[model samples]
Target: MASNVVVDQDSCISCGLCVNNLPNVFRFDDSGKAECFDPSGATEEMIQSDAIDICPVACIHWQ
Candidate 1:
């Protein structure tokens, strides 16, 4: 199954956890907020789940 991940920039604290956890799927924008650069890059569900779980501000979510 394909996953739809989204980061709420307003709620994101720029912790970089998601990027560190899944660089292929998440990245930091010019403003330093987390953004989904390539949702399709997340091939494994576990990695996606880990990203969501590791988000301190709970800004990452599935759309």
Candidate 2:
């Protein structure tokens, strides 16, 4: 099953970890918060471990 990742803007701390590592899937929005611009940009596995797992603010989640 393919999973879509989402970033909780309210919980985001703008750490840049997700954006810096998984730029294809995540990016900094106009508000400078991390957002999932393209859920299909990266593999679900990579998104889970690299973005969700490493999220300092626990803002990234599987949708």
Candidate 3:
């Protein structure tokens, strides 16, 4: 299955956990919220899973 990671901006707290965990794939926006920096690049599947795992609101999803 193809895989990708996304963060729900509405639910995101911009804690930077995802940024820290997946720096190459994630970046902080002007508002400090995590944004997809490389949606089409190679991503660590486990790290995406971890992002979903660590999200306080459970808003992260794999697509």
Candidate 4:
């Protein structure tokens, strides 16, 4: 199954943990908030789970 990793902009604290952990999947905007480069485009399971695990607010989810 293809899983999408999503980050809630409102819940994000700009900790940058997700970006730092999964650069291929996550990025930061001008406001310093992390955003997904391509949700549901993960080619590896480990990267998807890494983003979910490092999200400080646990806002990142896959479905």
Candidate 5:
């Protein structure tokens, strides 16, 4: 499946929750916001549980 994960930098608090939990799929950009570097890096289930669900700011989502 194609990668559909995305992050709202404007809403992100840069808490590192997503990156810490799913490093392969999420990471901090140069501006210090959480961004999806590789949506296909992890399984959809893992991304949903680890990044989307665990995000304190709820900035991550499907695109």
Candidate 6:
């Protein structure tokens, strides 16, 4: 199944953890907030889960 990934902009700290680790799935917008640019960019659930887990601000979510 495809994961519906999302990044809570308000809760993001602009840490770049997600962007640096998973550049295809996450990125920084003009505001510097973490954004889920492409949910399907991650080929495995574990990768997506790792991104969510590594987010210091807990802004990344899979719905």
Score every model by TM-score: 0.86, 0.92, 0.74, 0.72, 0.92, 0.85
Clash-forming residue pairs, model 2: none
Clashing pairs in 4: none
lDDT-based ranking: 5, 2, 1, 6, 4, 3
What's model 6's overall lDDT? 0.81
Superposed on all Cα atoms, model 2 deviates from the true structure by an RMSD in Å of 0.9
RMSD of each: 1.5, 0.9, 2.1, 2.2, 0.9, 1.5
Q: What lDDT does the true structure give each of the candidates?
A: 0.84, 0.88, 0.74, 0.74, 0.89, 0.81
- Cα lDDT over the full model 2: 0.88
Supply the TM-score for candidate 3.
0.74
Tens-digit lDDT track of model 6 for 1-63: 776888889999998888888888888999989888888877666555668888887777777
Model 4: number of backbone collisions: 0
Candidate 4 residue runs with Cα over 4 Å from true position: 40-44
lDDT of 3 by residue, 1-63 (tens): 556778789889888777787777778888878877676554566555757688778777776
Of 1 and 5, the candidate ahead on lDDT is 5
Q: Tens digit of lDDT per residue, candidate 2, span 1-63? A: 767778899999998999998889888999989889898998888888998999988888888
Q: Give the better candidate number (3 or 6) by TM-score.
A: 6
Candidate 6 at 23: error in angstroms?
0.4
Question: Which sections of candidate 6 miss by over 4 Å?
Answer: none
Mark the regions of model 5 whose C-alpha exceeds 4 Å error after superposition: none
lDDT of 5 by residue, 6-62 (tens): 898999998888899888988898999988989998899999999899888888889
What value does the lDDT take at residue 50 in candidate 3?
Answer: 53
Clashing residue pairs, backbone N/CA/C < 3 A, model 1: none
